[model samples]
Target: MRYDWTPLWRSTIGFDRLFDVLDEVQRTADETYPPYNIERVDENRFQISVALAGFSSYEVALTVEQNVLTLEGRKGEKDEKTFLHRGISTRSFKRQFTLADHVEVKGARFENGLLLIELQREIPEAMKPRRIAITGAGPGKVSQIEAKAA
Candidate 1:
């Protein structure tokens, strides 16, 4: 399936980045390598686990840029050895995940041949919702402020 974003691009302003992200996702939608899982631990916490049976911590790299998390894995030099049947896939691969605003990577760890990434949404203090105060006067009274010309 395909989509036409020309109309959206012409109708919206300041959404170029969003359209670009959508295009990128569409381009990589068919790439399924190094199986992974995305789990929501809680309302503000998320975890991404990638299965890398023959990969080690030293062979993988994680980076985040422009709200996008990229995972790359590259195995070390191969040793000269004969294998009766090669099964484990230690191939190099790259995967990317787009995170929402305020979502930041907390940490990552490799255990039991699986790479786990931790993420948390930390909204800035100024961006959080605030309560507004309302003042009212009685039916017969009206509140007014006296101002002096400066």
Candidate 2:
């Protein structure tokens, strides 16, 4: 199915990136392999965990480029054996995630058949909000000073 974002494009300003992301998401297929979870650890921290039961850490790869995080997994060759009832799947899969501005991947670890990726939003000190001190005079005093200058 396709989506029409023409109306949104006309009404919003400086949101081209947002529209682009939405378009990209719509064009991609809905993949369910290697389930994952996104959790908010704190106000600016997040964690993503993926279930990789049969795959080892060496079989999986993670890459971040131009704000896009990609995960790829390739199962190793199995021994020659007959399976009467195979339940576990060792299929390879690829996943992609788009990161927002100022968000960075801190690290990733594989433990107990799960791959955990950590992310943190680190806004520069200059971009963070800060309070400005109000000093000198009230509106009346400022108006008197302006009048004297006039």
Best by lDDT: 1
Error of 1 at 22 (Å): 4.9
lDDT of candidate 2 over 1-150, digit per residue (tens) = 888999888889999899988888787757888889999999999999999998888899999999999999998887598989887778989999899889999999988889999999999999999999988777667434345545
Model 2, total clashes:
0
TM-score of predicted structure 1: 0.77
> Which parts of model 1 are misplaced by more than 4 Å?
6-22, 135-150
RMSD of each: 5.3, 3.5
The candidate maximizing TM-score is: 2
- Clashes in model 1: which pairs? none
Cα lDDT listed for each candidate: 0.91, 0.90
Writing each residue's lDDT as its tens digit, candidate 1 over 79-129 gives 598999999988999999988899999999988888999999999999999
Tell me the lDDT of model 1 at 12: 96
